[model samples]
Target chain A: MNATSCYETLGVVRDATPEAITAAYQRCLGELRASLNGPNPPPPERLDALRAAYQTLGNPAARQAHDAALSPPTPAVSADEGERRPYPFAFTGEGGEYFRIWIVNLFLSLITFGIYSAWAKVRRETFFHRNLTLDNSAFSYHGNPIAILKGRAIAVVLLIALSAAQNAGPFAYGIAVLALLPVVPWLIVRAFRFRAHNTSYRGLRFSFHGTYRQALTAFVGYGLLAAISFGLLFPLFYRQQRTFVLDNLRYGSAQFHCTASNGQFYGIFLKPIGLALAGMFAIGFLTAAGGAPKLLLPLAFGVGTMALMLFLLPYIRVRTTNLVWNHVSLERMGFSSKLAVLPYFGLLAGNMVLLLLTLGLYWPWARVRLARYRASCMSLLSAEALDSFVAGESANAAAVGDEVSELMDIDIAL
Target chain B: MIAADYFDGRSSRRHPATLGLRDGTVVVEGDFGRRSTALGAVEICTGADQTLSTIRFADGAMCEIRDSAAWAAELAGAGIGADAVAHAERRWHWALAALAGAVLIIAASYAYALPWIAGLLAPAIPQAVTQSISDTVLKGLDGGLLAPSKTSPQRQQEIAAKVAALAGPGQLPPHRLLFRAGPTLGPNAFALPGGDVVVLDELLALATRDEEVVAVVAHELGHLRHHHGMRQLLQSAVVSFVVGVYLGDVSTVVAGLTALLLESRYSREFELEADAYAGRLLLATPASIEPLIDTLLRLEQAHAKRRAADRGGLFGATDLLSSHPDTAGRVNALRAMKR
Candidate 1:
């Protein structure tokens, strides 16, 4: 008999596990192949039905939607009551624990002559991801080390080729650089896809759906202007790139949205520039008026620059983070970041001092401190419970793109 | 029994479940239903301290245990040790041992393996490539740092002839001599990758004897014979590549510094090789190795006086950072070779 539902097409029950569905699909495919090679081949309609069923049921989000379409709609509940409940994020990782992990990773990587770096990356990412908890559920990373290793190998080869070309001749060097330009956009998109697909929260995988064309427009087209403009048009570039990345991101079927405008990005960047200029003017005026001592001028300039340098990074970080998260929404749920610049600057300055004093032995502790503070500053604004979200399909992406971007020192951060 | 949150993997819904072992079978009981499988059939990812541990059933359902300590103790009570990797990562001593082992391996590789590999690989590079590279470097120097030779034509011709006679005739990949006036460089004789030996005017003006000029030329010839310039380039390339991979980013200031320090160490070995080569070459000629030694000492004393006058100017490379070996050690080695 011809089946009406995907469950019947797969010859499995509604409550069958993912493992059972996959097994049934494989068995049906094997039988279909056998019949095609036999005296009488099955109709194309049978092949269509099998493929359509698997496509719908293989993805958790699509299956949930399909099931909902089949069943009667349940009555809605008003859980919000015109108010949002804030669920604060937590990071449980410790410095001492991470230090041990880092040392072991470094040791294994060294002994293997960098072959183990792929595995080390996976383990380090796992440690960070699984320690980050939101609403009693920790995140997870599922990157394959073998894929990472293959990507790293390719990246190393490319790096060696580029360096060798420089020594070969000017013409060869130009050819090498020109050849790499077209692949840049593709690499950026693939890297985003790989990172997003491997990250999960509450069994629902995050996905990046940005294409190469969009990456070219956002990274290359906007990036060139930003570089040549000498920090004037950088805010617009930042906004465009952020929009390109965030707008295409999804958790299950819910799309992430960035509502922050270009003006907001400009506002964040300009505040520090204005402050630094004003500081220089004040210093100049005071020295010119003979109000400040001669010996104190250099000290004053040093202090002013140091203070500005410390304030500038955190100021932009806090503002952009708040601007992004405050305006970002995933379907019905929203996010909030109450990160203050002063405290973050203090923490960063302290971390830097400790890093220098300890000759970088304080790295693990510094990371933990920053993560904990940032997590403490972030919270999820959800009116409804998080359990209703469905898991999305994981896209196929290679690690080579991610490794190549990393080797090229591209900072694709949120 | 331990409490855990389970996901069937087909859906995002979480089911609060009780997990336990019943006669070698791992059972998961929740409001959704009961699922059981052989203990060995399941996959357990017991992470390090403070991190969550996950157990996956045969049906692709996963149970997340938040209380890792309790789960770990339960597994231990049931005669199951933690995963090998987590165990290794958890122990402090293992991490310490790994750090020590890494340091030893990196040090040994830097000391023995890198030079041997670079030396092996250098001769394989095409001459055309080296020629182009040398041409570019010479053009770059000529554009800014080097001026036309101000030495008189007679003196330059005579010294060049003497050096050519010392090098002998019919040599494959013959050396080409170039003269430049480098007031900034003081007295320096260097070899390029394409067998071009650049002798600065200051070097000739500083040398009292034609034998001293010939000795310096012989050393430059030694560098060409062994392909030392190409080998140095290859070695530095390898070092930076290794450092870049280790740090995962080439843009880091530390990586550049590390490459510089390592390259300097490798150059010291090359300097020694060149010294020995010049020594053997001089022994074959009427002149002894003494001119080479005297010229080196004089150059060192002149640089030392300049260093003191400027107190090692900001742009000036100090003796500690110099690529060449110390004059005293090099002279002692040359004397030992003569003996």
Candidate 2:
């Protein structure tokens, strides 16, 4: 008998009724039972198989489900059908709803002397993850609070040790800082692994496959190069870091590919510097050429500097996010982002203003607002069905790296 | 029965299903298949605000119940209730209570707890560290806010000796007096962590008599004796650090400025404390507390004049964010102490 279906196992056709299936099951079981006492007795496992088949096909609900599973899948939408519009990511989180969670977390954390912070982190991440949807499927976070607490404890200890070393003397401080240099890359990699392994979409977990050696080269070696070159090589370093992170990321069986070039990163960072320099030159030309009053010179410089400062950060952030995400792909699925610089800057400025006005009470609302805006600007650049990807082998990553990096304020975009 | 999305965990496939609890078994029947597992065999993750409850089977299959209310009700009917944290998070009143509790706790800690902790901890810092901090702070101020003293060497020595006589000997951390020309700082005197009393030239010029200068230095010596500088540093460090922890996503500039404003209150208390110390010391000497009172009045006049001239840079941060106590309060406190 074919083992593929219950009907086949019972020597019955697909359209067999419940009575027919039960009869087939009874006959098969009797035959096996009667031969049990013979020298060439049929195995008892055959009887068990017959009973199992009978059990499933005997139930109407189970039979209907079985039939559905056996049916062929519907054809996927073809690309040539002109239905290739990207799927927009949506954030359904509300300010008032999140504020409750944030306040409660804060209160608990304080009362527990910060021990509850680990649980708070889990809840916050879960809140964000569950609210974020792509193509109607939400993501999920499954981080353990105990792991986070342990990591935070270790990070606090390290922080105290570092401070103590600083007070001990220059030599001790140097040794402490130098020791941390190697650990930085390790922590970065671990953080990536921990974050990715815990995030899930459609029951398939994301993962990071980057090794420590690669992280060190990207974060430390290139970081040193950027620093030694007085930040001239910073764009290259940034590209390397992003590539190292993006290229190693995996969603189920498909690996994410980042085709973002170093030159693109250079363009993202250099344009602002170029604009600031031009503004400076223009100001200088006006002042020297007697185009404006000398009394307004300091004001002009101050305004110019402030404008440049405001423009630079938002511009770089928007351009880099668009550059990196737009060039990223997971198998046939691609990513897109249209985060405009001015709107982002406006949002941030408004958030800061309201934050000040409310004396930090605007924190939860600000986060929700930012999350909504960010989600709006992002999309999946694919028309292909999302269910084709398979789950990969799951692994547990220690939260120490993630928590420590968080404590150190190292922002690694996922 | 609750409608849910089920995943076999072998692939990223969604199977629309209906889940039911029967005889301690969770049965998920859907288009794809039917899975019935003993309730005790599956893991149930509690739901929170707007998040679904997840039920995981031993074979890596899982189900997500999207209707939080219905799922919660079902779980309750089945004797599986929300966890303690989730229960607390479910209510608006609890959240508000937590907020009130947190605010009260933080305020109480800032007002009473931090001062007590800093006072106990400040004197316990190693002497070498305190000395290093003093040197670093003064060096950082030099050549920028402070220039070399323009006062004649003789006058500087005379005032230093008078202040030294006031402090007396056998002070655990012996005091050292230094003079600098603080044109930018303008009529200020401060004590450092390791018993360094710095008196600016502008401050000396503001005084009418030599005894007034000694009184000002004597006030700074009071700060040294109480380790107010070190205590202030410790308190502010803790404040900024806690603010940073609590507001991790906030801009560092904003957090630091907020910490600074909050810390000004503590500084005012320290100032008044140093003033009382100065008043007591002056009462023991022939100069009396009259000079210290006069110096405070003079400094207040100078500060007000500078305030008018500067037009309140950074939106009058100088007066609003001033670390020093108001002159009236300091003078009144000193007068009361003198009696």
Candidate 3:
């Protein structure tokens, strides 16, 4: 995927008027609806994405931001942003202060037997959002605790039903697994909506507008293909999934455009698998030549697994971040991540060692370090003020769907 | 007077403004021109950001000051303050005190509360549920790694009768004594939380004496008596809870994986308790703890032989070979209690 600006995504030209943009957005939605292969209409992310494009293009202020980002040499937009230097996201949460809040929240949750976890969830989300600054402004979370509790109630009931099904008999368990297969895509959509709807930047809430049919097609349809092909088509599935989800995302009314390609996904995946295979071949040859007849098989298996994990895990982390962020843009403001394989690999491996050595007390520091690195590594390739681009949304998605998602522990958001 | 930055909330333009109190009103003068509003007209959010304090007008125009104290000073007499920062930044003493309190609470819960809860909940589970669990597990195992026991049916029944006789007076009559060929789970015996005691064919063949096999059954019986499986599950849930509280994301896959990884793993204490229970149960049998001790040492040796044979080394690295408690220590402890 390349930088297909929101205007292009909604099928509008650079100078399209507000009325023209709205007409284009509606046209885009209708085309999407006609293209749906299911009984259901487009998912909220799809509509939200189109709506975001409409919102931004419709508003004079936001339009100018997009225009400025599109044509940076214009000089007028950058002047208002105060500083033209590269701005990195910043986090100022101290372990000590957060620890106090964390422990209190934990203690309350324990006493309440998980009832207080909703409140804890809100507190923690709010804390992280408040600390994370993109440019000078920060993000905010506006999830409702009572609504989350209700969602959790539903989730717990579902979990009980699932657990019961597992022990009910083999036939019932098999049916349960098959039933859950179709629900995974729907759950992902709900989770995306819940997350996008609750998160806000500059008084404008985030939104997702992908259709349910699209998700079903991507997850279930491609899921079957991947399974049949030993996951070789997984890159294509990931490509579709990310495109639908990320491209449909909106911060206020600005539709996000994801240009991440399947080829890039394959590139990231295959490199690690290739490296691991090469190491495996070397180890296999050495052991086979040594004449340690009895030891050969077990050592090959163990060392192969160890090498694959060592190479694959870090490779995926770095390359996937580069693939996603470097290809994705909100309108014309590009998102980029500078994560390297070695550093991240070292961080994860060392963190594991530290966690084991400290008997888990190092978790807080480890978490902070990871957060700081990720935050610092991510940067926006824009000089325009980020807040100026997204216009406020009018639609309201109830808190229930998001809460339900929370209960199910579904997460694809960043 | 506090001169701070402002945005119209509709445009990206910044307003350089000086803010002051005017009795019943708050006055602001900036490059966008002078404007005054009733003090109640604006919503004041202190600590909206760690460094920025926000004042939002009903009309969507907003101003933010960097110094929280400076913003608070202007609004001190108005009594319209949402001091979220002061609340978060309690004294160092309070922070330390809370830390100590939290640590104590976590420690106490893990040490006592979890075990108590598991104990309370374990008895309520019906035999039907446990039977279903055993059936599913055995059925799944049979389709793949496990085969029918090659041992003669007559030998199987003889051991089954011993297990049943030993389990006769127990709180839980062991749900079922099952056997499977041991290609995968070599020389292993385990009790699922549902009370089924499964002995592998390899372990059955390795034990030359019936007393040795009976001792293993008695040990498995101890696990059932204390509901070790259920307790292990509960303990893992509690560990996940602790992790969730700290990470602040209970819903993430990473968090769930962490919980799953921790859940089925037993602590050294659980293993020791099970061992002690087995020792007490076998005292009434013909060989006392001697056979149990002999079985433990032999199993350890058998496990070492398998690993050493496969890897061409590291018989000394027995710790890595097994998740079970140290067999030598267990044997010594069993010997010490042999009076």
Candidate 4:
């Protein structure tokens, strides 16, 4: 079938301004309307042809393609495209294979008593790189093996030191040993940078900039908060951790942006905690009131608290992390939002209480909450325009491919 | 020009143009006397001949007429299509709600049944009362149920020797027993219910020091006297009989017990009755009151440590357990002389 030509329907020259194209489209539509209801009405076929022509040319991508087709072809190919033609890396069981690789790596590390953590790390990196594709271009790893080994070696040493300190005595040297745990965070940052630098998509090498000290500082801050609040501050702690990780992570040449609104996010996070406290207070007051009536109050309070938290928790998370997208690229995307405290607390408390009461029946409940929470925090958009080239068509025709395709074989003469 | 008039309720104007004919068709002449046939219909033509004549239908239908003064109005309202709006899945939310409901059910069951069970079992078997009855039975066998004479200093030493001999070499010496006089304490003697027994001084005065005191001490020894103390330790350590009694019905017990344990305060009378049984048992032992009396005093001193440890393990706080009776009261009762 002959594809519709977007440029002809829009009545624009090859180098027409976007404004001029729009005006011409409006004029052509006006003329078509006049012809349809004039003293002599146009045939039904011509009316259908006009509608199809308008639809195709109205879309932007098809019009751009059609314009590109009308331009003269360049003799020389771009350096990037010439050196690395996009490759289609198709594997029948890609998802399953990646999952198996993760499982096997985990199992091997476990069997070897964590001696294989370094191997597992490399395997994970390879799996991730292999799966990532851009315009049929698969990423390849060119990371330094020695750097990875060095990072892993540092991590292992720290782990051993921590273990030795914990086992030395209940009190003696344990605190001193724990002080050295910050080294692990530094090693992780080094390892991430090493891995990212090795990943290549069409020769555009991926890199990340993160500091071990920063990660460690964030961890300590989170720990302190958790301790001070008697673990009630877990939601806030997690939010900080998430923000740190996301902000620190970089893909290819782009860096992610992370910003959180403390007040708005905390409002959501503290909701469940407030509800729980209120329920506890109510139960106490009712018990003090005395008689059979006092006995029923606690039960009602518990049930009501649970019900309210269950509904509000998800709502709070979605509202809190409905991230606003300020920037994105073909190779990278950044997200920023405030951490929600109340929803996290509600979800955590409600799930824990329910799980304890029901043995394990609430596993699915926990799973769904986690899934919804993840969905709330994540948003994806393709940075590059979705454009496909037609071999024989002009750029303008390609750009307005939809419009031209819709007008195929139609009689434009009235 | 096609003209029609109608009243519009929403508009402030008294009369408005009512477009569209009875058959939903409107045909009018355009500029330069050109005849235009608008498909649907037009009923009202109120403006000048140069006004853009158009047809608007009930179903959001608006078709522009070219340079026409009059045209049909086929009003068509734009209704939202089914595909345009997406329905949200509330299944996950509902599942979470159902789980929360289940948690509430279990918590409610625990809260309701536990206290009822505790109340039911508390009245059936009073540990203090049973121990007192056993003490009375042993005292009758010992020849004097009321009073036992105080032993000589030399005799006290000899009795200690005999208890030490019976205990054997490598073993620690038998706990001492003490005898004190107290008329209001009644005919009861008690093994301290821990590691020693105290014989009442009134009962000691009623009998000569040797055989009666020996038999009383022997009976008290039957309890603390051997692995019985160990048995009590094991029972108290391994089982939560109090909790079991309170939480026997799994459905309605847990929630109630948690609430009670977290909130309730026990009475002072409960401690005194337990002490009465210990006094009665000491009177039945074949040993002297010196060991029992010494142990009770030592217990009173060591009681703080035991309480601190228990509170640390159970509630992780000491202030919460402050309402319970202190050890000083029981020690004072044991030291009281005949009055």
Candidate 5:
């Protein structure tokens, strides 16, 4: 009768044979049907009770338990209950932790004239690795942090090479620049592999097998569409971006299995539409304001919208990166996690506008949002717990500590 | 179990702790609970307080107390820890998407621009067109433009004979002329403009094969004719000049300029008047009526190729040369020959 009970529908004794149970269930259904056919049927209450009782004891384990309970001693807890593994981790708000790392990374990166990107990358990787946990089991960074640093260095080198090539003559430079078309996607795949290899949760490591060319082609193709359409095809472009990211993402040592609904998959398209509409409204409003008001409106809207968007940025991020694992295994982790376009564009546009207006004064705020955005992507319970522990220890510790000391502190005079 | 106990006791507090027996030699604890029996002095506490009672041997030795729990928690909280490491795969995918978007946009923009740009630069001499013209002109002038006529029977054959004679000695092969009806053929003896020109058979019928036909052909020879092809080319170059002034290196500049050019339309009628000039040349020639009539018939038949070439014939209002007189009426006037 209970909503949670799955075993009650079939009528059979705990020790009944499978054949006997099937026969009994069929007979009960027959009786119910015959009664309904008769002019005067059994009361609805009796039928409902019968149905509930049958539903409850239909499952093999529940039938056995019911039969056993009617006899003498109770049996051990059912395997169903015992087999239900608790979720290893929980979601904890660690925005501050994320904020701190982001700030430190930003500061270091700036101080070193962007030279610290390698170190920043390593630190960032380390921070994310330390925070992630599964079923109380924390992940360990077994691969060298230097690998991440190395990857960043490679990226920097490639970037420098591209910039140099771009400055070269049109023909030679164009070829060089075009040559980089494949490199970015390649680096992304490599970086993912490197990062995945470095990470392990409960001794299970993860890796990605995404192809650089496929990712590159999809991106280039969508970009072409956007350009050909004069940016009018942004919705389609955004959808492609989400699909490529989600479909390519993997988790666990064994790939995690995931299936996203059409609704969920295409939900990302709404973001661009929303942003465009918002941009249009903003521009229109500014235009209508006229003269001096118009000038200030853009500046005000730019700053205000940016700050507001930054605040909502985490939600957008969480929604986009919403990944559900069908079955995460020890050997391969396969999962589908979407990287939504809305949050990314929102973050980018917001930061760009702020940068334009404040002349880089908004960099810190942007950095904080960026950190939060990245952290939002991570699924780590322990990191959240640790964050809470830190916050709790700092916020109310004076009171709790004094009370604890009063109780535990021993006095030699006594 | 023994190691556990030893480690537990040794790690009881932050301060250094030691154990010994009755002898002066310090006793060292070994695995399996075995210990050396010797007397020794051991410092349990260096400077740190040893009074905290909660400190126990089972708790493991305290290394440096760095308050790094905050940093560790922050790292963990931000998914900078193992969890973040675990998610490195997803991050890579995200990066890939961003990269793909960038590349696609650039490539597509270039693809869309190619056809439009090509169309804009269409009038510029295609290498094929320039080469063909050069070959045709040089062959026609192979006799050094003022060569003494040994091949011709008369005192001086017309320019057509001279050029045809020169062509044979110069080793320049003549191009085949395929005729089709054109709307611009009139009393006019017209040149093919480039590559090859069709002379009207109607004009040829009006004059003797050698007299009127040769002179009419000479004018065309004057255009293919003495370096006129080169001069027409110069005029075309001047007319279709492109100012490659870039406003800025930005794509917006190119896009705006292209949009403006696409909206602008060119006027027709310029080519139609060129047909009239050909007619004036034919009138001055001493060619016969039969040759002129033959030229007209030939031109009427060959006009189709001109219509095919332009998509709109010279007489069609939308044609580029439509401003000139109708081809049919001009032919009628040429037929009424009073001269």
Candidate 6:
């Protein structure tokens, strides 16, 4: 038997044709399906493994990276090599450096009647990615601005249409809503693919393999369930989406696995809301006992609720980031996040104060600080070198999805 | 000699190689393979960082060079690609220059281009859309704070006839007069996008002369003639659009609130343009310019008195005297042209 990286995982030979790879993946899945039907259902874990392998091989970029790992060109002698130690991310970007680019981008984008915004997006993303380095290599972004502009046009048309419909009448709005419902899942899936396909580390591109059917179930199917349940079931949908996105992702051929459960996500969502309510109740009880004025009672309750939300916001963010990072792994290589609640909260509060105080002139500095904090908190731990894998699939994400959501002015929360 | 890493394009394998240029030939040697390609066969790229450069072979193989001065010099001399080192940005003051340039552009756009573009685009938008916007805004105001005018039907007719008289021959006014008791808007008279000139009872109470009320109607007519209301809306929308693109974080409700504030903001130019149009109209007619200037002064006093009377009212933002153009400037301009 061949050593199972991705090719061996799918029972394919090295240098397998694209059709052969597809056939192999299908054959593997079909065999698993047969075994389940024959009254001995293979464990879901085995099915997951097979799916990961299929995703890895199916993507051109991942397959290329996997093939390279299976056959290295030379022996390495590195000063840093010992046991695979955790590589901390370092951000070399100075705020001053970034501000110049920012001003130039802003100036050009302004003078061009905003047509240069697409190029600005590229420049901006590349600047941040290049500055955040790990393992002596920085990440790279490869997206065509022309493609993004095309996407922007599509997004604006869709946006104007929906907005016009909403302003026309409630019936027109309802019709537009019905028409857009099905496209949400499709857009979510496309957005995931677009972001992943353009991202590369160590010359190897990352790819997402989530299917349209999977996206539809995770987004719309569960969205309806949440709506039916008065939003209580939203955590289940969130977990489903994370799994759908994380599991299908392949950096080279090393699969990223996320095992966050519905309960964990629910805990994160409810903590802030529950605390705010409790705080309001406590303030109400205290003020009533103290014989406070009616106006003062409302003022106390409002301040209490606001404070509670402010405190819980960072708590939820920190814990949720932990849940995502600690549970996600590439093969056995895990991603660990050391983001603490108070420190993260400090960052958030400080960022807000800075933004308010500087009239937004300190925006570049704020961005740099946030990026630095996020990068510093995370580290990849593994025994194998990350650079050995390569993938060829360059799935150019339809820029329209990003621009569509952009025009809609909605962040697609996963 | 230059130390570089090679990727054959077909595989993810990294080969540590020494690169040297010899008589227009680029030679790369490593444990995996020794390959030579003509310097012209490889496309070179200058990277963002000074020392990071990449050369791509015709076969899609790539070589990344670090600290690549000698090889870069040779390739640059041959015009392989622009030298990254040569293209490195200027020190320190470039930021200052960029800041200056940005400020200059913003000032230019704010002072000249924004109004010009708004004026050009306002007419191109379908009249139907503007009408619908007007109808919707009026409907909202009516259901909330606006009641039908307390003024007698006879008084309303008098104002309407005066507006028609001001329109004179060959030029029909775009709007008809509408009156309401605007408890929320508070002593305001403004033209909606679809040429609806709404004058509240509070504003009418401030008018002491028949000529004063006629001047207000004439000013509102001027707004309709040049589509100033729609032009103002379009200009602010453009401002918000630019802000949205530049700032780029619209996911929050805060950003939407900011957009709301921006859209409501009327530029000083638009206010003056409407003022000029009114000034020219009033001067040409039997009505003198004094009524227009007097009405503006009275309107400011009416607003100031209202603010002083109730600071706790719905319209708490009474910094209007500072926000709008100095009423004195508009009056002076009108007076100078009257002579």
Best model per lDDT: 2
lDDT of 3 by residue, B1-339 (tens): 787776664434466789888786988898888889998778766653354666778855677676768777668766655544346434556646555666787677767777788889877778776667667777777787678888888988998887666634655445578777857556778787777888888887788898888888778878788877676666776687667754443246767666555543455666677779888778777777888888888887888777766774442333332457577877777877776
Candidate 4's residue-wise lDDT over B229-310, tens digit each?
A: 3333323322344344334434346745454454332223334434444455444445534444554444344445555546
lDDT of 6: 0.73
Candidate 3 residue B18 C-alpha distance from true site, Å: 4.7
- Reference-based TM-score, model 3: 0.65
State in Å the error of residue A390, model 5: 33
- Give per-residue CA lDDT, model 1, range A86-135, as digits (tens): 99999999888888888888888887878999999998888889889998
DockQ of each: 0.51, 0.50, 0.17, 0.01, 0.01, 0.33
For candidate 3, the per-residue lDDT at B52 reads 64
TM-scores of the first chain across all predictions? 0.78, 0.79, 0.77, 0.46, 0.47, 0.77
lDDT of 6 by residue, A229-299 (tens): 99789778767767888888877554678988877898888877786677678767877698666687768
Candidate 2 structure, TM-score to reference: 0.76
Docking class of 1: medium
**Candidate 4: DockQ?**
0.01
Candidate lDDT values, in order: 0.82, 0.83, 0.71, 0.44, 0.41, 0.73
lDDT per residue for candidate 5 within B1-339, as digits (tens), equals: 111112222111112223322333323344323344222132111111111101111112211212233323433443334333223322435434434443464344333433334334444545476556655654553333322223333423343453354234544223222222222332234343354544443343434455545544543543432233343444333223211222221235554554334322211122222323334445544543445445545555545445676763443533322222244654555555434
Which stretches of candidate 4 lie above 4 Å from their native place? A1-117, A128-157, A181-188, A191-203, A221-240, A290-321, A324-379, A382-414, B1-339
Give candidate 5 regions above 4 Å deviation: A1-120, A143-146, A169-173, A232-253, A261-268, A271-319, A322-414, B1-339
| Model 2, C-alpha of B10: deviation from truth (Å) | 1.9
- Candidates, ranked, TM-score: 1, 6, 2, 3, 5, 4
Provide candidate 6's TM-score on chain A: 0.77
Residue A269 local lDDT, model 4: 65
**Model 6 CAPRI rating:** acceptable
DockQ, candidate 2, comes to 0.50
